[model samples]
Target: MVDVLEAGGWGLLAGSALLLGAVLGYTLRIPHQVVASVMAFGAGVLLSAVSFELALEAYDRSGMLPLVLGTVAGAAAYTAGNVLLARRGARHRKRSGQVRGRSQPSEGQQAGSGLALALGALLDGVPESAVIGLGTAEGGAVSAVTVAAVFISNVPEGLSSSAGMRGAGRGKGYVFGLWGSIAAASMVAAAVGSAVAGALPASAVAAVTAVAAGAILTMVADTMIPEAFEEAHQAVGLIVVAGFLVSFALSRA
Candidate 1:
């Protein structure tokens, strides 16, 4: 119980990025290029975490078959969920703020619903938070780099998404409340992950981890990179490389 609580606390700490980003979006008029650059950098950090921390670990433990299957399922799950949300008017779930002001009013309504941001945050955050707990289950501290990667990635997610939603007419209170709930959910996921770590077999761990990797990779490829390029243009590639190298170095440390 204590361990679970500790994991939950850490998850809360990490999840705070969402609220922080939302605050920035609500309070500041961030430039378009800055949003794009940050998104690109966050994508790079997330890529490193997925590649080295989640994908490699899953491959090592569960072999290729399980990892592949899990990856497929994870991607499918996120894609389906995104499609459903898009249909419901949250098409800007992963969109950068620069282009979002052009949406129709009805589309704004959907964005204001806040469901898209919440779901998107969960799709990305839960898995990483679970990994934190999984580390604790191994009788060790959570990887500092993993936390950094997740936290940093989440900031852009919150910032960009919040900007879009705010442009769509969502209230500051609504955005703050949405990110706050996400933070709480993250805490729950972390605690539950660690609590169940002892019961889950290594195969289960690997498959789940692979699921996260797949989902994150799909999200980055499908949404993040595209959005970054849309705004940041050529410089995003270098920033991506820089972000990846930095996260990679942290992982190595």
Candidate 2:
């Protein structure tokens, strides 16, 4: 149907942001301050997206029960999985430059580390991509704030992850291919989310929205905020504020 195609189009538009970030990460030597600034800004934008878009939307439609359960489950799931990966020496996922962890993993550990990073990246993209679907479901439109938050944050994440993968000795071909695949998968999830979103009941909507909200909040708190602060220190707070302002302005516009 036309709606499906439209949803697919929106999904591709949003997913392309991550691909752009990946390309930047692989090809350029972006400065750490620049990376930190983008991360902080992205975090702020995501905070707003969570508050106004996800939480408020769920509360308005389905009340608090689904919201609570969904949020808690999402946060818990992401935290547990991320912690497990971190323990496996893949914790430097948000590094601005090279991973500060083990530079020379045994040949065996290299693939493991790469896989962990890839999984982590996938987890990061899911909620954001789902958000694109939420917008399309409502009106076949996408939220600019959601797109901005996901896109901006992915720049630093891609930079760091790509750098870490290379440091782990992953080939360039493999690196691009991995990111390209993830981008494609995210686009598909968004498109499917759009196509099916209208069919879901209120409770299902609440669960899905709240779950995405919870996972994003946890991921930002765990990974993005800390990395932003680490890279930019006191300035990171201001950058976050600026990001919020910019996103707000865009939303209003």
Candidate 1 on 32-128: residue-level lDDT in tens? 7888898899889889988998889889987998899889988998898778767766654434322545744454554743467667888778987
Off by over 4 Å in 2: 93-114
Across residues 112-191, which tens digit of lDDT does each residue of candidate 2 receive?
A: 55567667768867766866776778865678777777777666666666665665667888888888787887777777
Error of 2 at 51 (Å): 0.7
lDDT of each: 0.81, 0.75
TM-score of each: 0.90, 0.89
Best by TM-score: 1
Error of 2 at 187 (Å): 1.0
On a 0 to 100 scale, what is the lDDT of residue 172 in model 1? 80
